[model samples]
Target chain A: ATTRIFGQARFTCLILFYVLFYGTYLVSGALVFSALEAPIENQIRLDLIRAKQDFLVRHPDVLDDDLESLLDEVVRASNHGVSASRNVTGGPNWSFGQSLFFSSTVVTTIGYGHVTPLSQPGKLFCMIYALLGIPLTLVLLSALVERLLLPATALLRSLNAALGHLYRPFTIRLVHLTIIVTTFLVFFLVVPAGIFAYLEPEWDFLDSFYYCFISLTTVGLGDYIPGDSPGQPYRPFYKIATIFYLITGLTFLMLTLTVFYDIPQLNLSSVFSSIKLDED
Target chain B: ATTRIFGQARFTCLILFYVLFYGTYLVSGALVFSALEAPIENQIRLDLIRAKQDFLVRHPDVLDDDLESLLDEVVRASNHGVSASRNVTGGPNWSFGQSLFFSSTVVTTIGYGHVTPLSQPGKLFCMIYALLGIPLTLVLLSALVERLLLPATALLRSLNAALGHLYRPFTIRLVHLTIIVTTFLVFFLVVPAGIFAYLEPEWDFLDSFYYCFISLTTVGLGDYIPGDSPGQPYRPFYKIATIFYLITGLTFLMLTLTVFYDIPQLNLSSVFSSIKLDED
Candidate 1:
């Protein structure tokens, strides 16, 4: 009986370890795969769709080294111009500065979903890079979170003690949550949204906010990407400002959550873990 | 006094509302702008950097697409082989099916960021399309989150209350988070990662995970894309599978987090709001 129990325990431990590492990859990888094939785009289709869009929309006529080359793509029968755009950064001419920027984004986990790699070799390398990087990001955030814990816990406890008389545990938590969410919105979301609207070309209020929402979730769908906006003379400065904001914002978010979690009396993650979920 | 207070409140309310809508874009746009202009990717610089990568990597020569049109770009000062890489659908004319798929990725926010909009108009439209689509995505996620909440919350509460004696609130919450995260990974990441590795020709486990991480973050870096892995026969099935995974995975991630938050007893958005984090 003792041997059997030990064997079972060992098996469980092995499964748990496998799940811990491979499990993360599985979920994360699925997200990537699903995102990749989810909607099925053909390069040719993209060209035609853009062809129609070109006729309908009056886009800013910008002149640049990149645009100049892209124009030639349209002139050719190749779909690279509008639809079947080729991945240009790989080959014997991959850009490190670009890669640096790419690396920063990946480590930050603020992936913009733009300028994807085309080659199989490139894809393989990127995968290896991320495995190391994602954990690095987590470690960075954890350290930040640890620093934020004491004050946050004290604040939560004080708030709870003060408000406990007036409200239930659930309602008080809600109140505390409201405060956290609001703070994030005002500083991280609203102020930045305004800055972007003012700085980025042609962005109105709605567009700016949409950009922020997409970004913070780390979704990074790059439709309204900045610096692409014309008339912005301080382009690099604007870009750097964004980088600072993302790093700080994410840190703050993590910090804020850590503060909340520090309250031993007020924690809730386990509150949801026990029941069986109907994932099917 | 009331008027002044109300006016300020109204302004704050407006800003808050604006942020709820556009905050993501603001964060992503700034980073993208920064990355794009960081003295990165000048053709000369890139070639020098990638020379080793180019020589070291040995890719199977893909025989599917022709190299005829790229010669024209090569003839021009545009040294990058704009015409020769990764148009799996093939040819300049393009079919309606392919075009629709391309449009869908852009508009849907499943944006592989592989084949991007080349023309300024196309890029601009891409932005506008994402703006509209982003909210739609949020709404979809919100709805899904709401739907998934009932079971998730029940699971958390039961698990926590039962395991309450053994763990702290933090551990409980972590357990719940783990459960939901696991469910999300199994259905979205693991299975999809496996499928992507299978479909993406040369993608190994690490590469698959990287793609998932990169794509889901919305970096759309395009460094490593799917369906472009040379010589895949069933392009359409692969495309559809990729698209489905993105939609479901994204929705599930939101659900996991949202369900975590939906526990009225554990809410924390109120914390920052109470602090009047923007009082200054």
Candidate 2:
């Protein structure tokens, strides 16, 4: 009875700790994104207003009683990534290169929807592509992660041997996990974000990082696509490279998750099961 | 040597079969979506052009040679779901109900970026919310699936008993799996799609199904969102109900996957490991 009670207590405490940790993480993200995006959003708004003013100055006769409303409509649409005038020309979104990239994103379950298929056929194809591609991607990712796990395990074993006398196995494993996570953050998040911030004229570091976080987690909101800038050189090549980056980054993410799950104490699934045992 | 050869042959056949199946599925979807969306896209284009022509007629002075260019730009922006005029007004997207719905989407990894966080604070909160919410959602879904599996297994056992003498165990299990899959499709996909199609003015059955499938799979492309139309009756209530629907649908999805994974013969992970064994 006492043991059961103790187990229940621990489980409750762990749940509480998890909630607290998650809350802190979210609040911190909000703070960081707010700081980064606020100034940018304001700048964009100002630029948009200036553009409107310029258009008005050029054509004063266009300014009627409805001019304010029309201008407001234009600005609102721009904020939502739309424009009022239809003259802005880019090639078809479903060009071969773009289509292939879109297909890759769909299969990976990223589904950015920034450049969606307008035709029914395209939408249908997307669904069909996703059904098969998702599982295939899963299998491929798992296989790669499985391969990576061998080396990761070897590293853990070495750490265990080196610290077996000085520390508990759990402590050593946690350290190993931290090292792997930091490596992921540096290579996938930090370095790539820096490159993206540099390459994309409009994006700041936080935007890039947010994009990375969103994509890596497979949330893929599609608000901040990398290479859609007008007159971007070698756009297809850039897109393909981005695809490769996503594939590799996803593999590393899975590898990190594999390592995290290996530490049974940190496993939420196991924790929940144990809590269930206490109830039973 | 013979067994290894057989395993390799099987693996090769499975890969080919998977590709063929996936390709066919994608092609069919393309065909369907093409047929459905072509007319819609055309109608939308026509309406946009009309809107622009009307605006020009109202302000004849605005019709310079540049008017054509300006109109085109406006149309192009609208096609991409952007707008130039900011006069159109609606309630804030992050209402208490909408925020709750958004939070649900984020944690589930559906991430329909259609209605994203514009404010810095909102974006930061979103990231932090996702960081913790995802794992918690996973834990909750897994626990629910685990419980469901008991009854599911019992159902499988009964099927085994009834079919053991006439059919192989593998055949029986496949039949059992088919039944469960059908149930999931009926309850989660078909029925809900019917309801959503009825509620959303623009959505047809296929669109609703696509939405459900996309959301459940966590692809969340965000082309079609529920309850976003202006002045929809009981908007908050509808949004909350949609949130519930997603949670339940996701739980059922996890259950279906659990059942699928329980079948050892269909296990891709194990198959890969066995192939590795042959290589070793």
Q: Which candidate wins on TM-score? A: 2
- The DockQ scores of all candidates, in the order shown, are 0.07, 0.27
Give candidate 2 misplaced runs (Cα > 4 Å). Answer: A1-90, B1-60, B63-90, B161-166
- What tens digits encode model 2's per-residue C-alpha lDDT throughout B181-207? 999999999999999999998798888
lDDT to native, each model: 0.51, 0.71
Q: Which regions of candidate 1 are displaced past 4 Å?
A: A1-100, A116-125, A255-272, A277-280, B1-236, B243-280
lDDT against true structure, model 1: 0.51
Interface RMSD of each: 13.6, 5.6
Candidate 1 chain B weakest ten by summed lDDT: B59-68
Q: Under CAPRI classification, how is model 2 graded?
A: acceptable
Give, for candidate 2 chain A, the lowest lDDT window spanning 10 residues.
A75-84
Q: How many residue pairs in model 1 have overlapping backbones?
A: 83
